[model samples]
Target: MLISKTVKINQTDNRVESVSCGECKGNKNHKILVSAEMAQDEDSCFDYQVIQCLGCNRISFRHALYEYTQYQATSEKIYPDPKQRLPIEGINLLKPYIQSIYKETLKTINNNQVILFGTGIRTILEAITQEQKTPGIDLNEKINNLVKQGLVTQKDVGALHDLRRIGNEATHSITPSSPKEIKVAMDVIEHLLQRIYILPHNVKENLSSPLKNKPNTK
Candidate 1:
């Protein structure tokens, strides 16, 4: 939406940037009907703009603040993957604690809160390690313990460690995550969940038939 700022806003002050119109359900340019300045100081000015979407001709209100020092845009809720409303819906068979954490993570992902997405993925790791009953001093050690238990292969553990590092970076870094990066990570998480929980359950259910006894100790 118009949440990202550009220096050209001063030059283009007459035109309100096109946003994803709720009525249009798509990005469309908007025309400003009024720019009633509400307040101003030496550094910034606030305004309430009445704008209409060019695509659908739907009118909406905009709360804007113009800053002389730097460009500032208002916060917005973004759904980069709207089709993925519940990114972790298939992880239902996982342990409740881990599943809940994963659902929360997906919520953040759906909101396009990049940093929170990473943190949420990291939390899922924590939940998995705990569920596997892997004991260690820290997460790295716990992940290694999971490897020892054969729940996670060594190579997978290495990749999980890398994800852990990236998650840490996301938690601390001010930079936002790109769609491609998060998509790859999301796929990995889904695969891991499938292997660790869903596949095992499927195997158990399929193998529950009466065993064919042969060469018995008669």
Candidate 2:
């Protein structure tokens, strides 16, 4: 039921709310630095505010929507959608282009760009295969070659194929992957990256000396 209500802009209302902080990469308490309200019509209004994160002192814009209906709850949105993911440890160990694509893919998922997310996931797989010099004419063959080359296991091949299919659907048919599918694909990709690049590098750097130490021979 739509009801008419007067919207009031309260500049002095000091309210704190939990909001996601891009800089902190998590939810934090934010204080309203400034606020204004605009009535779209008699039944709805928007609250615009400049909010500062209490933890990091980072500032961002927020838009909240309110409707005069019994069933509707307040809707709040943050500008530049709070970045919730951090770069994987040892991301720099990846090829520069792969690193760039990985970071952008994270942002794409966070922005809810479902089509781009699928494409990005597939692109990352392609770039990895290329960088590893996995020889194949197509993505399927390339993924299979990864197992033959010992870069990924046969079990991983199935997951990579899933990613390939998601990317194919998004690219050729413009089909958006569901959130659950995206999440699982992302987990698979990240694990693949760590297994292929990050973990090996870390082991070599941190454990090699101990493992390679040999008794002195005169």
Candidate 3:
């Protein structure tokens, strides 16, 4: 369980900063921070000193006995882990699926477009995920940075997002994705390829077959 606390930040104090609270009124200044507790271990850690807010007189307290725990319980539902590992499902298979998507995408575009559209998109996503593992990393900011760096275009990034979302949904759910879902995922890959590469139209016709439908004799 976790709780939030609102506090004022001293300008000299780097810990707390002014922020907007969506639950409260418009642009009201508030510093939001979390305190977490584990029920099984009977352990509690408070993040009170870590941050301060520039807004109201409100100071939030997070504890098992506090309302914050209730908020956590009500706002977010926690489900038990499926006790599953990758290669079986989830992000693990994305690389291969993406590879297949790349081949199709290449057919739609030019040979020179391959590098820009290939594993580059996958690498970008993986980098974001890795950054998110640490609290200091902001995946959104990094994506923005990538755009500023001209390493990837916003259009290409958006298509990558669509593909990642479909892959995630397929992995998390027990029900296998319908053919429709698979196609959508494949489309994301294709879009990325078309946006960056230049491929021959003749090659495109030959590569029209779906990777999932191809027969595997091996």
Best by TM-score: 2
TM-score, per-candidate, Cα-based: 0.56, 0.63, 0.25
The 10 consecutive residues of candidate 1 with the worst lDDT sum are: 75-84
Per-residue lDDT for 191 in model 2? 99
Each prediction's Cα lDDT score? 0.70, 0.86, 0.38
Which residue pairs in candidate 1 have backbone atoms (N, alpha carbon, C) closer than 3 angstroms, thus clashing?
Answer: none
Q: Per-residue lDDT for 94-211 in model 1, tens only?
A: 8888778878877777778888888877888888877887799988898788878888787888778866776888888855567887877777777788888988887777765456
lDDT per residue (tens digit) for residues 169-216 in model 2: 999999999989988999999999999999999988877776348556
Residue 118 lDDT, candidate 2, scale 0-100: 90
Ranking by lDDT: 2, 1, 3
By summed lDDT, which 10 consecutive residues of candidate 3 come out lowest?
77-86
lDDT of 3 by residue, 66-143 (tens): 233332222221111111111111222234544444444433232333233333334435544443332224444554
By summed lDDT, which 10 consecutive residues of candidate 2 come out lowest? 3-12
* TM-score (C-alpha, index-matched) for candidate 2: 0.63
Candidate 1 at residue 82, lDDT?
A: 17
**Against the true structure, candidate 3 has what lDDT?**
0.38
Residue 105 CA error for candidate 1 (Å)?
A: 1.1
